[model samples]
Target: MPTENALPQRLTPVLEARFGLDGGAMFGIIPQPLWSRTNPPDDNNRIDMACRCLLLEYPDRNVLIDTGIGTKWSDKERSIYKIDDQDPGMTDSLEARQLEPADIDDVILTHLHFDHVGGASRVDEQGDIVATFPDARHWVQDRNWSWAMNPSERDAGSYRKEDYSFFESNPDAPPLKLIDGISEILPGVEVLPLHGHTFGMQAVKITTDEHTFIYLADLIPTTSHLRAPYVMGYDLQPLETVEEKKEMLYHADRNDWILFFEHDPKQAFARLDFDDDTPRAVPVNPDEISAIG
Candidate 1:
């Protein structure tokens, strides 16, 4: 269902998987009953989560943003995440769009977290590690480049040695690490970095003559987090997230920005609003997402 405005845009999903984790863990300190009303959980107490990655076909490049959790996990790990080897999964979505593994030109990682960057690599014929996109350059922020290579003990799980070893081995593969501030990676698109959840995590901002849309990455995981105080516990600096959201939402409200959500299962883009000028979201379905904005 497209919005009132027709934005001719194509969004391909690299993955479509669900997880069952504690509802409390999903929304941090938010009360269970209130959040549950919006997102209900299962018998195991974990709510169904959507791990979606987007592939954008710009005129010149096949730019993909974020790679959902890859299939490099063990049976034990699979059981832990409750990985469903069923329909609506990553491969299914890719095939539906008539895309193959080698079709991607560039993988734009929003951050180094496992869920975001896992699909960056895949195992090859020789049992040797290899980049998922052999011909595509992998993009990351300069600050996060070092941070991921040398992650702290507390965050080591997010950057597994096995996953990144492929990059270290492939000397010729392009590494599109950002060298300057607020750079443009695609036409009519800009990378705006704001640190709160992870250092150097950038939200892609795309503007057209008619409207503006910002891919509010993890900044606003779901519409449930639209309110300023709904920062996730996983964020390193919650107060910083508050400030960042305040600035983003203020601009979103004034400019009538259509925000593209990363983790929201049903809706991808939304036009933001607030009864009292606070940050809120109006769902924008795929049909409504125009190439213009």
Candidate 2:
């Protein structure tokens, strides 16, 4: 196997969906004035965020990282989160690259939160919920699945049973692979679990030749969340999130990991930098990237 920081043979960034959320809740303890400067909010104090997913084109399989907030919500529900219906979604995104949902062989869900796993399934003409990627195996942590089955009062609202009900209702549905601990779920793709945000929220570490790309799901949703203490109030274990941020940031800086953000509006892929002993996330210009390495 290649060593750390290996670059991938092929990778593409796909913007599946976008939403606007309350700025205060997104930044948690950070003041609006401070966070708003980098991420300007709308008239209602809402910040724009993208449900971006990574598409890996390998010889054996085409893998998708997260499925974004899907089209399963009522108009009222969409209005509440300010989900943009005009934007191209997961299917549209895949079509742009000359591929269909059926072409996806695997989907690695960071967790089962609506925004992250909503697109995993969708409603058909008969109004029955079905797996969006009909031929793909959806991978999620066993611990996280158990927690979502019986969620705590604190996070019950985030767990929408309707989104994943297809799995329970269909006995012969597409495969739902339950993973355990950190392992290479796919060739060169490693899943690392971290608590504090949710029960088993995971970050995907992709090893490419001479480069390591980390998909920061909710662990560090946006660039503004680079600071250790700026964790979201939505986190089940806020303090644990903070601790994980510190350790992850340090590891990124030391190893030159390519950090990918799932929710940042303008910035998506970046590298961790340090100035005067302070760690910071510096965005990478796509033009500068010749490959995943």
Candidate 3:
């Protein structure tokens, strides 16, 4: 049970699929030796990553942040990314909290990347990909929606049409709400658009009277990325990513915002410490804050 000073009763982290990415690509120009010390790479030079989502439970509506990589991968594709077969995935995570997909009222997709939004839909029994949360209204940036529909050559592979096309083709599926720029989708849930990652990838900011939690989607994928220059090579605009990260980090440190990492493998939530020249992500035990279920 959570104490009075712990995380608000409504927030929990919903873990999804586990996958791996190339260490070099993940850390960009950072030397292998420097990054390998913390995030040791496997024989295949891949580092572990987790598709962790944030779930906000409310009396009237339940909200879910980015869904993980869905179960639509072929064996070859799974092998390429080194996806862990043992991960209990989204359904199990939700069941642990005594909720189902239908219970989710809104889904704020940080972006349309396969790893982030893949679980938004699934392959139905009739051999068709369908929306996973039939009752939830999916929210995404309009700029990002257009970019994903027609991605550039550099990031074409990241956008999987099958993962989200169902929302457009199937009228029975829940509505896909596309918003422009930053806006409050819900009363206290606001989506801030950041372009350094993809085109218009948004980071979710959930504010309460006493706490402010920012779901740092791919902007700051992991705790290791706390350093300004440790930007991912996967980012389209690496320099832009550095500036964006620095600004976000400064504000997060000053305001003492709890950052929810989407791709961090081991650590789920962290608070920034700016005592040193560089800001560091001090991992906070989810149990201490009652932030994970």
Candidate 4:
């Protein structure tokens, strides 16, 4: 455990929500013998996944990275994804640290995927969709907003209409603030747009005086995906994903950056070690990193 003094007010991981996804779909073209070795599947051939989100506490504002799949799933959808409804979500995670949705000043969505943005809104008493963090200004990449609005046929199925309808339904008071290119949405917190997983998907990079943490959103959902060629089948541009992974891995390895994975079930974050010029993912002790004074 880290001493309170060493903890950074600027970076924290919250809402450790778990779900089950098809093992084959996760690894794409990778043989079961290889991917299954790292993430063993259950009897249903589903592998456990974590929809981990991070909380950024700045002097001026409190920001949430991505909202995990919330409580809006239908019974069938819940069972299909093997979503653990009982698992404490964003609300509980925040309350544990003496906070609430109203306390969050901003929400930065990497993309509008149901899993990543589902928790951003909820059904109200009148059965109307409302912002989950009513007081916060949500940020999203402009290009992604356009892409999600008019999604390609290849990825149209992955997106749920209800998941993002809130953005459209309220034009007068749009909850989202569209960002352009790579910009620091917050002090020391920058968004880098990457293509492949989804158009205009932005990865959050957080830097402090002593350490840096890069939230790898869906670009690299798990540590096992460190391989340059292990691109997700869900990615629109598989080749682009491979190339981006290679470049990102090289930069991360060189800088010794802590790669925070969004869908890794067991490992929250990892470090890379180079062997024969190949960068390999190595799980690091979350406890070891909790304190970085």
User: Model 4 compared with the native: what TM-score?
Assistant: 0.92
lDDT of 4 by residue, 2-25 (tens): 432232355667744688888888
lDDT value, residue 69 of candidate 1: 71
**Model 3 segments beyond 4 Å from truth?**
1-9, 290-293
Ranking by lDDT: 3, 2, 4, 1
Per-residue lDDT of candidate 1, residues 146-224 (tens digit): 6778877866766776766556666755565553447777665678787887777888776654567787788888787
lDDT by residue for model 3 over 50-100, one digit each (tens)?
988888876567789999888899999999998763577888878888989
Displacement of the residue 279 alpha carbon in candidate 2, Å: 2.5
**Best-performing candidate as measured by lDDT:** 3
TM-score of each: 0.87, 0.94, 0.94, 0.92
lDDT of candidate 2?
A: 0.85
Residues 1-293, candidate 2, lDDT per residue (tens digit)?
64333334567787878898888988888988789889999988889999988998765568899898889989898888889845667777778778899999999999999999998888899988889888999988989999988999988988998777677787756899988889788768999899889988889998865568899999999988888878888899999998998888878877888999999987779988877876677878776765542
Worst 10 residues of 4 by lDDT: 1-10
Better of 2 and 4 by TM-score: 2
Q: Candidates 1 and 4: which is better by lDDT?
A: 4
In terms of TM-score, the best-performing candidate is 3
Q: Residue 165 of model 4: what lDDT?
A: 75
**Can you give the lDDT of residue 123 in candidate 4?**
84
